[model samples]
Target: ILPNVTIRMLLISTIESLSYDSQRYLGNFIKRNDLPIPFTYYLYNNETNLIDYKINFNLLAEVQCLSTEHLIIQVGSPTTIGLESLNTSGSQSLRSGCIDTLFGTAQIDQNKEKSCIIFDVHGTILSGINDTIILALQQYASLQFLYVTEADLETNFLPSMINNSISKPTIVCIFDDHYDKHLHDEHVNLVQQFTNRYRMKNWSHVQWFLIPTKNTWLTQSDNKQYDENERIQTLRSQLSYILQKINQTIIDPTLFRTIFQVQSLYWSLLHYSMNTLNYDSTCYFEVESELKQLFNDLSDTTDNLLITTPISYLQSKIKQNQMDLPRRNKTKFVIDEVQRYENLLKKIDQISDHTQFFIDLLTKRTYMEVLITEKYLEQWRSAYEPRLRSELINEKHKMIHLTSELKRIEMLEKQQKLNKSIDIQQQLQTAKENYEQSYKTLNEIDTKLMNIDMTIGLFFDEILSISDYNSY
Candidate 1:
């Protein structure tokens, strides 16, 4: 009874029994039900009087939960046909119950690894089109229903919608009613506006699509039956492609969790810097306690991820590598993650070194604080200052080394492009240019990093300034 509800009337009849008048009546019924959401009908001739109950049940059940109505009529010999309406009713009940249970289970699984698909529609979407999308998603294992939210352009509502998404791998499908073979000017303007907003944010993780509604071809095609079939098929194909992308793009949870934990540890260390020191020994003691706690937490996190996770990852990578098929992006991601784990380990080792040096410096300074005299100042200037300068220089050089490692990764990416390209000579030339450009870019990054490192070094250098210690 809803104004936007779609109505599909399916007629399954034998050619011998479905008389001209019955067909005419069915056509009139369809015409009466036709609305903006494309209330459509499909006819299947039951020539052999054999019903594919499973396919019929699934197709019927797919759209049953939506605000749509289906009028299914079976016209065959009484002996050949059972009560199909009853069968459809039972199937719908079974499917709806199962879906409710399964959706709950899927939500629980989402806590471990969540991904989402968002649908943005100009108006109401028909049940049949939704049914096609469900069928397509069913083909992929990694895809699951997380949640759906509406996006409104009139209020500039897209940014809020994006922020509300909890999952990392998100796909947004914006269905425009005004898109035909050529997009309407209004639709084009809307797409441009939304795309500009999306691009401004540079949302790398979320994939965006502007999809034409199935009803676009409704008025364009004279043959309704053929056009509807084609429309549904096209919808199914597009859905499959998008779902497959989401499936492939899923990040391995172990790698994601590990990376996040490590990055958090790094930031925690940054906050635990020597700048927190007052001239009092208790201040140094407080920083040492916090630094030690950070080190313990970092060690525990890295131990769990590095020891157990990499072995499992390597085994999986081996299995994927042994497979005959071309490697998927996930396999490549695993390889990249292995490399990242190595980088993280090195960075952690560097952090450990820095932490240990500070700990030792604090202990020695506190020990000599009792003997504060001209002799102590001379000993500090001669002994500790060179060590402090050496450590500071080492820290500055480490930034350069880290930046080079990033440059190497960038070079590897260019090498990958060359490996995939068909024209080797041309690709080599392009790669050379890219390498040169990347090298130049990397030098600029190195300079910025050096400047940042110098700024940090000033803070450490201030700690060893001796004038600050002279106050004691």
Candidate 2:
């Protein structure tokens, strides 16, 4: 096995350009699988300014592929003049993947919108935990900002930054609340290390911040995006915020310490800069591509399915009506849930109407196919549109059902208040749960049903054969 190597020493000029990516080679790698050794890569360009320590430059160019026994190394460029020169003697093995090295100009811009546009992070500049504080960090800058995130929070994330060449200040929001003192301290250490080691000139704000609770999240790189090697695969996350441009007034407390973690130093700095609360906040989902995905998924379904699960959930709630102690709390919850669901359904519809034009634009795969393959677009539409249609139908159904549920609940509430002896609480809870369960079930079933119908229609006219229906 190859001995675990540390960044015992790395020599570079100024890290000109930093891209969070797998180590890139102008060529490829080949190796056998049984060589038990773990591997990673770090690279720098020729002008990396590390000419003085050329002798200890024990860096591996990269291994290409692996088999069960032999580990193969692929040297692509002439820079192998000073690469990893190691020999091993052990039963250890190297499980492997690509190691990316995207080194270019060292980005020192706290103003992400202006400088770090290639490796963008999210959450810091999207919506806050409070929802009202949208894109606070990025908006503070004069430039328009875009927020992106993948469900996978580890490797997929940084590589995306590299692929997109996103150097912009982005916030990687924490979706989970798991924590450790050692881990937290590590993050704190990283924030301090980069600030001190990199010695960024004219840099003002601390770059990263952690938001273990809702009270702390800043649109700062310190809040989320940190340049640390140990964090590459660590299961920890922080909220990110980048100063897109310098602000002249009191920094938003929302960007720094409040009820929680203080990963970014922006809030503290802002107070010293100016002491006035700022009002210019951000509007959310402006670059509604993700929103459109949900729309697309719903649009693809047939019309029969109605009422979405989210709508039902939103409607789930308790009312102010009194009930017998045995089931009053339960009934109240149901009533409240129903009201919330109704409001959400209304909101979804409102959103749909607001963005219908975008849907029309997206549905025109003809335009997309001009740049992509027709077969691919066909597959995408078939896969996505029916799902979207099903969502729409399910949402409609929820609104319909919830509207009925609400009326029943109101009656139940009134019965308890006016007609003293009605045992409606049990009935109310049952109704609410049933509606909630049905709403979820319908969304799943509706899409399948719609797909079946659409597929049948694509093949024939008035009547669909039983065999065809079954096949779809």
Candidate with best lDDT: 1
| Residue 277 displacement (Å), model 2 | 40
Superposed by TM-score, candidate 1 places the C-alpha of residue 228 at a distance from the truth, in angstroms, of 2.4
User: Candidate 2 on 1-472: residue-level lDDT in tens?
Assistant: 1255322212121121323122212111211221212222123436764421111101122221110111111211111111122222221121011111111221223432111111111112111121111222222322222222122222233333222212323332222222223245755433444335436433342233322222112223453645233343342322221333322222322222111111022243334332232433322222334334433554434332232222222322222222333465576665665566456545653322312333343465333222222222343355566566767676777768776986788686886886654557666777778777767776666546444332212322212221332345
Off by over 4 Å in 2: 1-166, 169-190, 197-298, 301-472
Q: Which residue runs of candidate 1 sit more than 4 Å off their true CA positions?
A: 1-151, 183-193, 212-220, 251-472
- Over the stretch 1-472, how does candidate 1's per-residue lDDT look in tens digits? 3432322211333212456435434433433453111122232347866422122221211221111111111111111121121112222312221111011111213233232211111122223332232222222112222211223444433454334333445555555555444333654544566656557675565655555543564465578688567667765665566645565455432121111222233344345642341111111223334334533433211332232222323334445554623555576666666566445433432223432344355565542222122222232233334444555566556556655655665566678774764455454566556556555655654443332231223324443432333344
For each candidate, how many residue pairs have backbone atoms clashing (under 3 Å)? 0, 102
Scanning candidate 2 in windows of ten residues, the lowest lDDT window is: 64-73
Question: Please, what is the TM-score per model?
Answer: 0.24, 0.21
TM-score, candidate 2, is: 0.21
Candidate lDDT values, in order: 0.35, 0.31
- 223, model 2: CA deviation in Å? 31
lDDT of 1: 0.35
